[model samples]
Every structure is written in structure tokens, then in C-alpha cells.
Target: MAAAKIKKGDRVIVLSGKDKGRTGDVIQSLPKDGKVVVDGINVHARHTKPSQGDPQGGIKRSPAPMPVSKVAHVTADGKATRVRFEIRDGKKVRIAVKTGEVING
Candidate 1:
């Protein structure tokens, strides 16, 4: 994978599509596919028959994976920003392009 910038648990803002301008936490990351599933973003409804655990499994909404490029990292102040890597204190760390803040993925 080509250095996945967004990791699970990071807050991100949608850059385009239906969820543009909305922010959510990254729930899952598919490094190989270069996609990320964010909470409350790209959700779609699915119909399923009643099951043991979910008796009313009807019209369940779940998040779908989106291209990693579609989302931008959110800074501590809640602004969307691009990420870059830099060597800091003998360790490679991600820095926010807008704020120059160190991001902990």
C-alpha cells in the first residue's frame, strides 16, 4: 500500500460526493484498496430477512467504503487539511499541511 495517510479512528471531512463537507470518524481502512469506511458517510440501505440476532433485519443502513482521496484529514481545530510525512525526532510523523500540526494516526 502507498502510505495510507488516514488510519482508523481519525476524524475526516468528505471532500466530494453526497457527503461533501460532512465530518466523521474513520471506522475502517482498506490499505490495499485505498479506501476508507467512515461512520455516517456513504451509507446505504440493505434489505435482509429476519435472522436470529436481528429479528427485524429490514432496511439496515451501513457505511460503504469510499476512495481515500475523497476524504481529507481534520485538524485539532476541526479544519480539513492535507497530510504530509516528515522525520521528527528520529521518527516519521504525519504533519497537517494547513496547520503544520503533528497528527497521531
Candidate 2:
């Protein structure tokens, strides 16, 4: 398997699924599973009993992991675009394939 083009903290737009078109920061990336958890997207309600953490037993909303293929990277200009890697200043950098802007640190 190859490394994911999107990393944690990167902004991404949902390309498919219930949250299609919604954009959010990447919370986590699971390359092995080909899934990524985006903030405030793919939310799932989980029922839990009262515990030491929460006395009120109710449904809790949390972001669930979705397939990595379901998302596309969002650029600084707020457009969804493909990514490509390039060598600049003796370092490897990720750039937006559409706008040619460096995306990696």
C-alpha cells in the first residue's frame, strides 16, 4: 500500500457518501484500511449507558471513518483538487495538481 496523499490536519472535501460536498479537516488517516476520519463529517450516533465520564445516558455524536477515496484535498483557495509531489529546494513537497501550490510543509 502507498502512503495517503492527505494527512491529518489537512482540509478535505467529501466527494461521496452522506456528507458529500462537505469540507473539513482531517482528524485521522488510516492508510492500511484506506479510510480517513474527517472532522464533523460522517457522524454516527452511539448510545451509551451512564458511566464515570458521562452520567447522562444518551446518544453521542461522533465522526466515523470513511473511505479515503471518498474525499479530495481542499486547497488554500477552497477548491478541491488532485495532489502531486515535486522536489523543491532539495526537499520533497506535495503540491496541488490544479493550482501548482505547495501543500506540504
Candidate 1 displacement at residue 92 in angstroms? 0.7
Model 2 C-alpha lDDT versus the unseen true structure: 0.90
Instruction: Give the per-residue lDDT digits (tens) of candidate 1, residues 1-105.
Output: 468799999999999999899999999999998999999999999999999999987888999999999999998888899999999999999999999989986
Among these predicted structures, which one has the highest TM-score? Answer: 1
Q: What TM-score does prediction 2 earn?
A: 0.91
lDDT string, candidate 2, 1-71, tens digits:
76569899999999987888999999899988899999999999999999988999899999999998889
Q: What is the lDDT of residue 92 in candidate 2?
A: 83
Model 2 spans with C-alpha error above 4 angstroms = none
Cα lDDT, model 2, residue 46: 98
lDDT of all the models against the reference?
0.93, 0.90
The TM-scores, one per candidate, come to 0.92, 0.91
- Winner by lDDT: 1
Give per-residue lDDT, candidate 2, residue 88. 92
